[model samples]
Target: MKINSFLLILLFILMSSVTSSSQAKEKAKHVIFIGLDGWGAYSVPKADMPVVKQMMADGCYTLKKRTALPSSSAINWASMFMGAGPELHGYTQWGSRTPELPSRVVNEHGIFPTIFQLLRDARPEAEIGCLYEWDGIKYLVDTLALNHHALSPDYTEKPEVLCRMAESYIKEKKPTLLAVCFDNPDHVGHGAGHDTPAYYAKLKELDTYIGRIVSAVEEAGMLKQTIFIITSDHGGINKGHGGITMQEMETPFIIFGKNIKSGGEFSESMMQYDVASTIASIFGLKQPQVWIGRPMKQVFK
Candidate 1:
């Protein structure tokens, strides 16, 4: 009788462990990260972005999310994907195709470890895709880790075409991770100025593209299993960024769909590097010790 009771107790402990593991598993099967270049948080109030505004109303969002210092494109983009700041990842300049300084730790790929490489390592068969309007973005991600990647031949002029390509990719591949980067807003910001009418107008146009992408996800039948993360690298001033001003520092971070908390305005501080860690959390992958970013698990259900 004593041996039987001990066996039953062991069975109960095993069952409990299994249940706990099941409960702790991640809910999202796909994460679509949308990055808008030069999109500043300060412009949210006056800008006419109905689709993104609806996402903010229905999802977790914070307008106070900050970018890494210098607030330039390549530096912050590197931070957003590499899960560390310039001082650590070593991509410090505005259009850094390669690390300006030696990386603290580089993966076998010779570049600093990025979220894409982490996901690829954890899930070998997972589909990872990236479509970017700016050619510079290609240099930031691990192309060897991605299953599909494209650069817009039109450069930053047309975002709608990029959205169409994304739509097709979503329906066909049903990617585990997809990053769609639009550069038109930043292009307009540099040309006509950041706070000008053209910038807001470009945002409104981009909102339609965003809506279209969301619809495409639904059409591909991944909405219930997918999460949408909309964010930006930096905001700009009159016609430029890479400064200390709030407009150049603060950007919006929005997370929606698939077991995420609704209408959550996270007061907890978020930074650019946190985006990569959050993506890692969605995949149930452990972050490297070198990564300083923390997952916003507060937004998860």
Candidate 2:
């Protein structure tokens, strides 16, 4: 009886070790796409964005990514969502003219497939969510596809509220993909130039939200396999975008997560369209043949 008990104990130890190791190898189960509407690419290294820097410590980063032509918020966000530019996605109008929220978008026109539509069609059971601050979101995606869609006030004064809702939902739902759109930086950037002190301060505040969301992911035990793609639709030029100037068009892409090349900078060219394409490719979702955007191969480990 003593010998039998010893053998059983050894078997249990072996099984426990094997299970722990298996969990360690498990990849991230979801993708967290943190899209900062007007997040300036230049700040990735220049500004004191601790959260962005911490992510860079384990991800492939680039400071020179580009947004689509017309460099406006509405048009580029469409490109970021559908992996196509304005000419292809058909979003000509965007952003606020005065300080009010923009009108709802109509997708009744013949629009190309978006990440949301493809995900719903391909993985119907998989849950997805988005917390945004802008009304242009109506034009950026197919509303029916999102299982949890939350928005802040239309005045762009509620990023903290948006983040809190997203963080709580992520902890509870653990969706396959969650895009948290923080607009306060863009709001601050437009009023005060991109290089101004206030702009950096807003970025620091944004970093806190990023940290909270990451912590929430960690608590959910999905941090290891969760892929984080941090990017922006456009930067700022003086107080506005929608121009050909590099400041308005230039943006950044910091992709940090499981299966991604960690602790390195990618020299490969990247852009807003690539952002959508990468999300599709990361999850083995084959891009449609007609899609022009291609995933950045260098992002993979």
Leading candidate by lDDT: 1
TM-score for each candidate, following the candidate numbering: 0.95, 0.84
Writing each residue's lDDT as its tens digit, candidate 1 over 176-292 gives 999999986788889999999999999999999899999999999999999999999999999999999999999999999998889668899999999999999988889999999
lDDT of candidate 2 over 1-301, digit per residue (tens): 9999999999999999999866544335699988887887766566788888878877888888898877878777777877876656666656522212222332343346778777777788988888888766765776677787877774354447877887798889988988888775688878887878888888888888888999999888889879988888888867877788887778878888888877577888887888788888776677765567888877776
Q: Rate the local accuracy (lDDT) of all candidates.
A: 0.92, 0.77
Lowest lDDT 10-mer window, candidate 1? 151-160
> lDDT score, residue 200, model 2?
85
RMSD of each: 1.6, 7.7
**CA lDDT, candidate 2, residue 71:** 81
- Provide the global lDDT of candidate 2 against the true structure: 0.77
Clashing pairs in 2: 27-225, 28-225, 28-226
**After superposition, candidate 2 runs with Cα above 4 Å error:** 1-27, 96-111, 154-158
Poorest lDDT segment (10 consecutive residues) of candidate 2: 96-105
